[model samples]
Target chain A: MNILEIKDLHVSVGGEQILKGLNLSVEQGSVHAIMGPNGSGKSTLANVLAGKPGYVIDRGEIHFDGDLLNDVDPEVRARAGLFLAFQYPVEIPGVSNMEFLKAAVDSLAAARGGEQTTAVEFVKSVRKIATALDLNPEFLKRGVNEGFSGGERKRNEILQLLLLNPRLAVLDETDSGLDIDAMQTVADGINRFRDAHNCVLLITHYQRLLNHVVPDVVHVLSDGVIVKSGEKDLAVTLEERGYAWLTD
Target chain B: MADRLEDSFAESLIANLDSSSGSWLAVEEIIDRLKSSLTPAATKESWKYTPLRDFLVGFTGAAAVTPDITGVNQPGLTMSALSAAGEYARGPAALANTGPLPLADAALLCAGDAVHIKVSGEIAQPLEISYGEGVQVPIVITLEDNASLQLIERNNAVEFCNHSLFVELNRGSRLNHARSALDSNCCDWGLTQVRLLETTDYRLQQYHTGARKRRAETLILLDGRGARAELTGAYVVESNSHLDQQFIVEHRSPDTFSRQTFHGIGAGKGTIVFNGRIHIHPDSPGSDASLVNKNLALHPEATINTKPELEIYTDDVKCAHGATVGQLAEDSIFYLRSRGLSRDDARTLLCRAFLKSCIEGVLAEEVTEALLRNLTGP
Candidate 1:
């Protein structure tokens, strides 16, 4: 069964159409990669799926776990087991990363009729994740993404995904700012979070990430719609051909 | 209302005066100054932004009535007294009062008498003071020679009250004063004067919330060489309240430095005013000072008036001032809301962040918590 389905999705910003009649679907326990060049609506698709404001949805029907997803808020979508690892996470000065993550986790848990985690319990869980991501305990004390290196920020995003344990994770260019070692670490984290009940939509422009955590399906998005869909080989083909054949 | 208030004020003033007392002489001097230098129609540049006329009209009277202090809450410091006792012991005794200042209009002849704090050496203890309601109570704090102390003062009253604080800092001393006003019923007016000896340093952080009418004025004299002063203030005014802060820092000696930053958030029909002035004498070479005023109008009818002035006489000195008034950043709000916080929650979060710098400077944790609770409303 499809866990998420987007049909005829069209989006616009400031009267400029971006996504036009995009169609895609993903089943549970699968990893999907959407590869496209810059301004090919890859990031726009991620943002629109996450329900970010200011994007005019002219024609679309998005179903997440069999429920209409367009009208819900980004936060509500998060509570409903959807997570977005932003391409460029914002730095919130004076708000510690630990405090923010705990609040987000507690808010989601509360919505799911689960008891809020105690600080001690949260610290224990966070320490484990931080260790896995090669993050120091001191990093949690610092303000959210403030003064953090680009690699550290990407690791922090994975840390949130690990702690929140959402059913569907949409990563927008998570590997964009990572070094080779950091890229391996991020891929490792993605692989660790994969399970039969969960899915991931990895949005990227490079095929380097696909080499590590191979995608179950690769889709090419151009001009707001998915022009081609195939297994992992398509990414290599696009990487080698460089969209020259596809345009022709 | 003005005539009745003036008449009542005169009667109360007379009732509090002891014709033969030496302490009463200061009261007379203040009154004389008010009459001559600060008249009902006085055009003091500092009072231009505020409706001084309306505040004076409501001044009504200054009475000597003993107030009830049983329910007055004391401001708590971030550090524990036991942990800070050694530091506290060596601090300026006159500035170390840990409890709330005696309520204005309270009988301060006995236990409530002003404590003299003399800072003579280096001390790390942070002192906190809270104020309660009523008409006439005086706190006299004196800082002396090469002394250093961090003092946090909080004014939180549940009912109408009037309070006055008189402070003097002498030569080479360092004083960090932090104050917070968090109650709605408080109609408070505070005047602080600091005199710096050679190379003395002073910093002030003031914050207020939920006041009917509140005004705070700070006057600093950089009398000795190398004296420096820094002032930072923020306020969140709601309802129909009016809040104003006026500051004057005079560079009387060469090599003096001073800077001021004031911010405010006005909602509902509330009004806020910030007037900051820096004066550098003709002979005060190597003097540097600047003032910045920023405000956020959270409502259409809310008003904010900011005037930052610099009077520089020495060509060698650097001085500048700037002011900005606008609403909260829309992108910040959207960012928070995107994180799952409701719009109201997002606004509160950003507001808290805006005021956090001032609140954190307050070394006392309990006082900070109380102020945050009050400003954020429950």
Candidate 2:
């Protein structure tokens, strides 16, 4: 079963075309990595899948977990097991991390007709996940991403992904700005969440993260469309040669 | 031009007043001044957006005084109604110089009896006062040096209410006061005055909601060095309700610190207005003051007007003021909703967070919690 299938995906932002006739398909349980240079509409694809506003869909069809979404709100898409780890996680001051996570988890589970976890069990599980991700347990008491360092923000996003267990996780540059140990911890989390019933769409620039969370398939995006596709070696080759050769 | 009907409408309130009505001379003085100023909402340099005329119209001519006082008298507390015998043991000194507004003066002129709170030692339990429907009374609180008190005053099911509260904190004294007015179809008006002596600490948080027109104005004076004050407020209105508040925080001594934060939410065709002013008097060097006012217009027809004014006369002082009148942050809302929460739940969470930011600095956790529950539904 395909968890996500995008057909002729054409997206525009702020009166400009960003994703022009892009196509992609992620089979259930497979990890797909889309690598691109700056301005290649990589982030645009992630945002469009997450159902952000202001991005006009010129023409496209997105089927998530076998459900076609032509007019689904962002929250609806999220409850449908769609998750996007933002490139820059938004900072919501005055909302404790614990409160936000609890609401989020509850919404996701309730939408899927799953039983809710008690507050105590939720805290214990979240604490274990935070510790494994090298995140401070005390951070749960603080405001969401308020005054956190860049690395800390990235780790916090991973913490959400680990706990949510979404069917499709679109991580936009989740490994950026992280030290070596932190990157390894995040990669381990991604690896643990991978299974035959879920999918991962990893959008990134550097190949450093692909080492730990090696993708099953790699695609190079340029000018809003895929220009190259290959195995894991494609990322290593692109890493060494860079996008200059393909563009010229 | 001031309308004679409006001026006379205010005049009618002073006629046949309750025990709150003090000396005839003071009452006459207040009435005479209304002919010109008429309690603001004019083209005056300050107070332009608030149309006091609409509010004063809720004044049903005569003040309604509800003299019901319940609850046990704790060891460190004293309670009274406006007309009970010997209530005059406390004079009008607590209510003096606290009012220049016609409504405030009019409310004072109707003062029948007063509830006085005198604290000379530390009190851990909170003191609550509920003035029944249309209760007109002045609350006087005096704290001796090295003492502290927590108080909550509530006005329920009232119309044309004029309650006065005065607090004086001596050296090293701390006082936390919370006032709320939430009666539908009522016009509630309140006046609060505070004097902070040397090393005295003062904090006040108010939540006003549900009235056809509700207004509370507070005047605080930082009178000695090392004095500190933090005032937080929230106004919630829906379905044609109106909430207005004006605050004046005066820094009179060096090393004094004061902060003010006010948040308002208007859901229907309601109107919310707040004017906060922080005055750094001359020679009050090393004083630090800041004021922030924000309002959320949940409905397109809802009106929100927020202003933060700073009058700095000392060059060595630090002062900052800011105000914003708009809807909730679209980005925050989107972020929350995108995380799987329903749209309504998303808005509730964001709105609660916005309100918490206003009063989180206060030391009264229980008071702040109760206020949050009142402002934002369960």
Candidate 3:
């Protein structure tokens, strides 16, 4: 079943159009990889999906789990099982990571009318995810992403993705600034998070991340819209041949 | 005409004190300065941000009420009234430099009899002093060598209050001072002056919720070598409220260290001003001092002014100072929202986080909770 369906989406920021006439679909239980060069509107698409302010959806129809996503509040979209792992995670100096996570979890659970997770269970789950991502459990005590390295920020985003357990995950260039080992760890986390009930939308610039978490479908985004769609092999082809061939 | 008005007000205050307690000789010099130099604050660099002259133009001084004191019954501590401890309370009011404002001296002169607390040893229990409505009282505290005390000062629903606090920390003494000015819809002027002797330590934790017209001034003198002082404060200004905080930390002895960190948030149409100044005397070589003032403007109409001033006469000292006025980061708000928090919740979280630096400790917990509870939507 299609978890997300976008038709004729046009997005603009500050009156300058970025994503023009974009259409895509991601099926449940599948991972879709989006590859593009700089200024290809990849991040714009990710932000648009998250309903970030200043990103005007000029014209589009975004359906997430059979609900219209246009003009929907970000928190509303989040509570509806959508999550975005930021490319550059924000550094909040005084709000501890543990506190932020608890608030997020409680908010989501309350919106879903589910029982709030107890403190012990929440801490255990967070520790488990942090350990799996090679993150020090002590990081939870520190401010959100405060003084974290580039690789550690990406790992922290993945930890959020796993902990939030949203139905559809959008990873925006989460592998841009990672070493081989960190990338492998993040990839393992993404692989572990993928199941038959949910789906993943992986946005990236290089095909290296695809080698670890191979996507079922690869889409090449150029100028504003997705210009090519194929199997996982297409990511390697684009990486070798360069985006010039497709853009030209 | 304004000068005459100011002088008349000063004379009235002096007369009031003279009738009750005839010890005007101790603070006569300060009163003389107050009469001569009560000019319009607009031209004065220190008082420019605050319109003290305007606030005083229509101001009729309030009645005096004694502060409620507690926890002083412990051993090694002595409490007395300023009238009885005549010569003992003289030195603090007559200190060489009391900044450019005469507000402290006025508070001293107007207060019929102040509170005097003396500590001779480590007082395990904390002393709490609470000010009632329309109270203008000056407090004097002296800690002997190797003595330590935790002093907490609180203002309770004060309509109009003037407070002046003086402390002398002797050699190797330690003072942990916590203050809360949480009354709203009132006019308040407060002054806190402290002198630390050799090897003495002083720590201040202050929390304030803004009032209709409020100005708080703090002066710290690190007078002896190896003396240390740390001052931290947080304030939240609501709609139409005004808060002006002026602080000066003077390193008069070599090897003295001082740190000041304060954070304030302006919610709605209020005004918040912070002036942090650090002075290092030429003889105070090896002085290490730093001041940080951060302000958050929660509403578009809120006004915030922050300035960090540093004066170093010696070239061998380390001094760092910074001031910032900004709104919450939009990206951070969006990040929180993306994590399932509503816009309001996200803003509250960021604000609480911003104030966390200055609002953490057992002493600050109650006032902090109260301030957060009374936080109005921006």
Candidate 4:
């Protein structure tokens, strides 16, 4: 079953065309890698999927779990199980990480007509994920993304990804600013999160992260549209030869 | 013109004064200063952003004085009536001549005596003082050597009120002061002056929801070596409200330290003003002072004016000052929305975070609710 379907999606920002006539589809229970050079609209695609404002959807349609997503609010899309790990996570001081996580979880639960998690249960679950990601529990008391190191910010993003447990997770360059150890920890988290019930949309410029999670499908995006699609071997070829050969 | 109003106000005060009102020794000094010092006009640099005309209009009528007290009896604390406190009231009474303090002078002139509080040892319980209902309150506090106290002041009355507070922290003494003003349709005027001795510590946490018109002036003097002062304030201005705050910290002794941080929000067609000034004297060589004032404008029609000024006479001191006026970051709002929070929830969260640093202590929860009430639009 197709979890996400983008049919000939055309997106523009500030009256300038960025994503022109783009088409893509991700099946359920599979990982897909999107690789492109600079200015190839990789982040734009992730933002458009999250329903961020300022992007004019000139034309096309978006379907998520049989629901039209083009007109959906960002929070509505989020409650329906779509997540976007920001390339530059915002630093919100004074709002503790624990409080933010609790609000998010409760909002999602309320939207699905489920009871809110108790304090003890919520803390136990958060601690479990924090320990798995090697994150200190003390960090949960501090402001969200406040004074976090580059590697720590990436790990924090992955922490949310696993804890939220969304149907489709869009990792937008999450592995860009991480060291080898941090990268391995994040990849391990992704590996543990993928199961028969969910899918992952991995957006990146390097093939290093794919070495750990190992995408099932690889697609090359150029000038706002997918230029080629193949199996996982395509990522390795692009890493060796670069996009210059394919673009020319 | 403000000059005409000042003359009439001063005349009315003198005509209404009772023979008992002049019992205090500081009354003569206050009266002299009231006549000599002109009411603040918009042309003056210190009163540039504030509209004194609106403030003077509230004082045109007769004054009704209501006196009351609460939460003063506790261990290691002593309270005395101002008339019986004797020479102790002399110091605070002289403070009326410090500047063009019309409101402070008016409060002290009408007030025959004030509440005098003296702390000898560390007190665990906080002291509460309430002011409002056309009442003018003058308070004097003294912390002996190594003594400590927590003071909380609040006013919820619907009528205009004036408050004057004077604090003296002796050697090695400490004081934690907090105040909240959360009425929607009232007028308030307050003046706070503190003197810190050697190695003494003083901290103030002030929270407010703008009234019909409000003005607060605070002065902290580090008079002894190794003295320290910390001041934090947060306010929210809504429809038909006007708030003006002036904070001045002076380092008069060597090796003194002071920090001032304030955050405010403008959510209606109101006006908000903040002026923070730090002065380092020539003899104060090792002074370290920092001031920060940040403001957020939730509505374009609201007016926010902030200025941070620094004056250093010595070259061997560290001083940093900054002021900013802006709107909430769109990126932050979108980030929160993407995490499953609605737009309104995201705004409330961000607004609360923006003011979290300045609003704290026993009344944090209550003050937070009041400040965010009109801010989070319906």
Candidate 5:
């Protein structure tokens, strides 16, 4: 069975139509990339799939692991193994990152009807993950993403991705604003998250990230529809020709 | 409605204290205050936001607390009763006795004998003045030159209590004062007044989990140069309970500093009110003061009134204050929920975090955790 299937998915924001009857599918253990120019509804696709607020779905069907997710709340969708790494992750003032991770991990575990991780074991596990992402252990004590630089915020998202270990990860422009070294580290984290039973969806405007983490399939989204789907060469073609040729 | 309750409440409390051993002079000030308390409605400027007429039904038929605190194990400490030992009676205190508020006078009239605490040198274990049972009690504390001490005051589970705490710190003296009060169907009033001397530091922290009707007031006077005061308070009121916190800080001398951070949360039909006033007197050119009051109303039916009142008599002082009344941030909540917390769990986490930073310098971890648990629980 496909890990994610979107059929006739029409989504809008602020009464403006963005994703107009978009359709796509991702099989288990496969990595799919959606590359489009600015405002071609790349982030909107990730948001709609993660159940973000303020998005009006005119018509659509979203199935994750054979379960219909259109009516589910954002948190419920998250517990059901759908994760979205936001392009601009929010900075919460008082909620410490470690505290947030503990609560988040616990929530996911509880939703899965599994035993909660002990605080000691969880701390040990998260510290290892934080170190792998080159994050200061002290950063875990600070407010979530507060006072973090652009690169730090992006890396922090990767830390969550590694810690949560969701079955389907939707990364929205995770490569933007990252330096080469940071981009390589994030790619490594994403590569680490790839598993046989999980699916990975990458949303980007450039093909640079695709070089580090190759995509099994690439989809070109324009005006809310997947106009084209191809193998890795399609990304190189778009990077060389730009998005105008496809629209024209 | 409040006027009638005030009159009757004052009458019965006064009668009870008159039956005690206290001199008429002590109770006379109370009589004067009670007479003036009825006319000025809670709708007046200072008490405008507080729904006291509807919530503050004065306590009736409650007894006065006999001063039982004595001979604390800590060194450089002593205790006495104001009514029994006239020398221990510290008169003309500030706060509720400041010409307008009547609760302090009623407390003085009702208290069998207010506790008088004296510290002369470096004190170890905190001197505690607790109303462990159901009674109204008043306490007066004086720290001599170069003396330092801590006071852990616990007043909870009382039917009705109107108490006053007076603290005077001499040159280079310091005091750490902490109080915890969490009870219901209880009309509780706590008024604390502090006078700081040269180079003295006074820190007071009060935590409450609500009551039927409650008001916790802290008034600090930085009377000498280089004196500093840090005051923080947090309260949680739910159901039909009411919680009011008033912080009055005055920099009376140059180079003095005062800071106050307050947090209050309300759920159900409860009302939480915070009134923080900072007065930088003239000639105190080098004074620095700040007052911040933040409130969170958990349920739609809950209400919060937060006001930071600044009265500056000089242009040379640096003063800042801010008050914000908001519920849990939608984005913050969503962020937490997305991580795995249910909506309710996310709300609890935010509420707990709100109360954590506000209750500072509390030595007893269990006390602080207990208060946190009470507030975060449904």
Candidate 6:
């Protein structure tokens, strides 16, 4: 089944058009990769999908799980099973990582008519994911992403994706700052969340991430529109030849 | 205009003096000191940030006696509240109390509640005091040898008002005092004074909001060996309100340490001012002190004035003070907004984080929760 559909979407920032007329679709349980040169509106697409303000949507329609997403809030979209792993996660001083994750989990669960998890249950459930991501248990006690190393921040985002278990996870440059080991850990976590009920949208500029977590479909975004679409081999071809062919 | 207001207020204070009791003599002495020590319109360096002229204009009436809080029930306590008391007693309560100084405010002498508490060499219970509208209160607490006490005072004012407090700590004694002022619109003036003795330790935390016009003053005198003091405060001003805080710390003996930090956030057309000074006397060798003031402006028209000063006569002391005024970080706000949080929620979250650092050490969970709820709103 189609989990998300974006058609003829135009986005502007500070009154300058970025996403001219983007189009994409993803089926449940599939992984879609979007790659292009710099300024191809990759991050802008992720942000607009998450309902970030200032990205004036001049025209288009975004359908997520059969609902029009133009007016829905980011939190509502998140609760409806959409997640965006920020390229640069914010550091929230004085707010412990544990408290933030708990709030996020509870908010999503409550939206789905699930009972709130107790403190003990939450700790237990989160520990497994934390261990899988090779994150220290003590990291949970520290403030959200405050003073974290580049690799540690990437791992933290993956940890959230694992815990929240969103239906359509948008990984926006999640591997941009990660080292080799950190990238593997993040890819492993994403694979664990990839099941029959959900899908993944991997947004990036490099193909290194695709080596560990292969995409079922790859789309090249240029000038706000998908200029090319093919199977996983397309990423490898683009990584070798670059976007020279797309201009022709 | 400033002289007119000062003269009129001073005159009203003298005219309303009750000539019957010894307390009235103390009130008169305070008025005399105010007239002599303060040059009505002198524009002294210390009063630069505050509009003393405007404040004096509203102080024309006689200092009214705060009604007795005989029927009000004491607010309940929490574990965090108790812990704050314990921390204060163990750290700053080992100094001496040399009685009331002569030049201090005399209204403090007459109206202050002086409680003689024996801390049993440790803090036993968390102390809580609640104040409502039209209440002008003064309190003095002395901690005995090796005794410690955690004192929490919550101030809620409803109408045009004034609230005053005076505290003195003795040697080998410790005092942890936390105050929250949530009702600020009812009053035109508010003041707080604190003094610590030799080897005495004092810790004070104040949270204020919702005032149309408010002013807070804290004065600390470190006179004994190994005396130490810490003062931390946070305030949120909204609408067309105004808030000000003035702090002075004097190190009179050797081996004294003091630290002060004040944080403020202003929205709408609100204005905030913070003036802090640390003075190290010639005899106060080996003294260590620091003061930091930071303000966050959330609206285009909001205004903030922060001044941090250090006056040192002793060359061997370590002292530093600084101030900063700016709006919320654009990157931080954008990051939160990208997470699907509305702009309002994102701003609220960041503001709460900024204020939490000042009051996180509070021992009363209930008070902390109550404060967070008030700041974040429903």
Interface RMSD per candidate = 2.0, 1.0, 0.5, 0.7, 1.5, 2.7
Candidate 2 residue A151 Cα shift, in angstroms, is: 1.8
Predicted candidate 2 versus true structure: per-residue lDDT over B112-142, tens digit per residue: 3445566777887777767665535566677
Q: Which candidate achieves the best TM-score against the true structure?
A: 3
lDDT of 1 at B187: 73
Q: Residues A70-117, candidate 4, lDDT per residue (tens digit)?
A: 989999999999999989998998999999999998988898898999
Candidates in order: C-alpha RMSD to true structure: 7.3, 3.9, 2.5, 2.7, 3.0, 6.3
Per-residue C-alpha lDDT of model 4 across residues B39-141, encoded as one tens digit per residue: 5432357667665545555453344354355666788888875653234334433442334365666666666676688888898888888886664657888
Once fitted onto the true fold, the runs of candidate 5 whose alpha carbons sit more than 4 angstroms away are: A113-115, A118-120, B1-18, B24-44, B50-63, B67-71, B83-101, B132-135, B367-378
lDDT of each: 0.70, 0.77, 0.85, 0.84, 0.78, 0.71
Candidate with better DockQ, 2 vs 4: 4
lDDT of 6 by residue, B1-378 (tens): 546645455556456544232332234445554665445333555456455544443332334355333212223211111111211211222121111121123333333332222334565556666555542434334466656767777666566545555555667778887877776464545555555677888898887774666767677778788988999878777766777777778888999999998777876677787888787889889999999888888878878888787788988899999899888876666555444455676677677777777764464354454444544443
Docking class of 4: medium
lDDT per residue as tens, model 2, A67-183: 887578999999888889988888998899999999999999899899999999999999999999888899999999999998889888888988988889999999888899989
Off by over 4 Å in 1: B1-32, B39-45, B58-62, B65-139, B146-152, B156-162, B259-263, B267-269, B288-301, B318-339, B361-364, B367-378
Enumerate the candidates' DockQ scores in order: 0.28, 0.78, 0.87, 0.79, 0.66, 0.37
Q: Give the per-residue lDDT of model 1 (tens digit) for B228-323.
A: 898886677776777878777888799998988776777667778777878887899999898888777777898888877677787788888898
In model 3, the Cα lDDT at residue B149 comes to: 91
Backbone clash count, each prediction separately: 13, 13, 0, 0, 0, 27
Using DockQ as the yardstick, the better of models 3 and 4 is 3
Q: Using lDDT, give the best candidate's number.
A: 3
TM-score of each model's chain B: 0.76, 0.80, 0.91, 0.91, 0.86, 0.78
Q: Rank the candidates by lDDT, best first.
A: 3, 4, 5, 2, 6, 1
TM-score of chain B of 2: 0.80
The runs of at least 3 residues in candidate 6 whose Cα sits more than 4 Å from the true structure, single-residue gaps closed, are B23-31, B37-123, B126-139, B143-145, B160-166, B188-191, B329-344, B360-366, B373-378
Best-to-worst order by TM-score is 3, 4, 5, 2, 6, 1
Please write out the lDDT profile of model 6 over residues A85-190, one tens digit for every residue.
9898878887778877776777777788999899999999888889999999889999989899988888988989888888999999998988888889999999
What would you estimate as the lDDT of candidate 2?
Answer: 0.77
